[model samples]
Target: MKKKFLIVVLTLVLSLTGASSAFAYDGWADSKQTAYQFQFPVLGVSIVLNSATDVDWYSYTNNTGSPHGLSAKLQSPPGLIYDFAMIVGGSTSYFSSDTPGGWVKVTIAGNIAPGETVYFQVRGHTYSQFSTTAPYNFTITT
Candidate 1:
């Protein structure tokens, strides 16, 4: 009886640990759905910056219905700048419409100077019918 009890306890502990680890990454689960849309005559866009640790270096989207591409541009106020763009998620085929949208392993260049903020904007178009929440927002940590 004691051996059986120990095994049950171990299983419960392992299950809880796994569930917590699953959400440890910094990213959005539904970025495409939450994206703001422009009316017939206007352009609307939104940007989110997610601070991440070395384990998960960049932010990503978790939607399975459609994939979207993210473009990152690092701007340091007072005239310093750099830009990097990639299709972070979804099918790589340019003609496929069922790609997932989010960031991949791409890294940003330059550090956000003390008291300064770096901006990362992810944008894309999706035809899937779903609703999204705002992309996960992030702040720099010294």
Candidate 2:
């Protein structure tokens, strides 16, 4: 009976995992879906950048009563590499790492008023410091 119960739990876990992956938002920006949209606890979402100036915009609202902090992890796709960084309000902030295609974690502390629109940008650090461009997946949190 114990072994049977364990098997059932394992199967359930695997099914739920697969379901989450199936529902994960995939693809780039479009007219309706202007940017990669997500709330807290976003799963693996695709972010593609072609060059230094290229970027992916993510939008979220500040609904928490007070200020809330935000962070996102950028992971390289398959075999390629990129230097990931984040900027708020169209200005540059800090980067996750210096290595191309390496994992970059961006952090921000916000005291935004409730119902304010927050824009966070995900960009690649290209061959140039001012312009390192590439692509990867990102998970954001607040």
- Over 4 Å off in model 2, which ranges? 1-27, 30-33, 40-44, 47-54, 83-87, 94-96, 127-135
For model 2, state the Cα shift of residue 69 in Å. 0.6
* Model 1, residue 44: C-alpha shift (Å): 31
Give the root-mean-square deviation of each candidate in angstroms: 17.6, 6.0
Q: Estimate, for each residue in 1-142, the C-alpha lDDT of model 1 and write its tens digit.
A: 9999999999987655321212222344333343222221222122332222101122333222433332232222121111222232332212112224322233334322232322233322322211133232222221
Candidate 1 Cα outliers beyond 4 Å, as residue runs: 21-142
Window of ten residues with lowest summed lDDT in model 2: 17-26
Q: Candidate 2 lDDT, tens digit per residue, 93-129? A: 5555655456777667775557665555555455332
TM-score per candidate, in order? 0.22, 0.56
Once model 2 is optimally superposed onto the true structure by TM-score, how far is the C-alpha of residue 14 displaced, in angstroms? Answer: 8.0
- Minimum summed lDDT over a 10-residue window in model 1 is located at 75-84
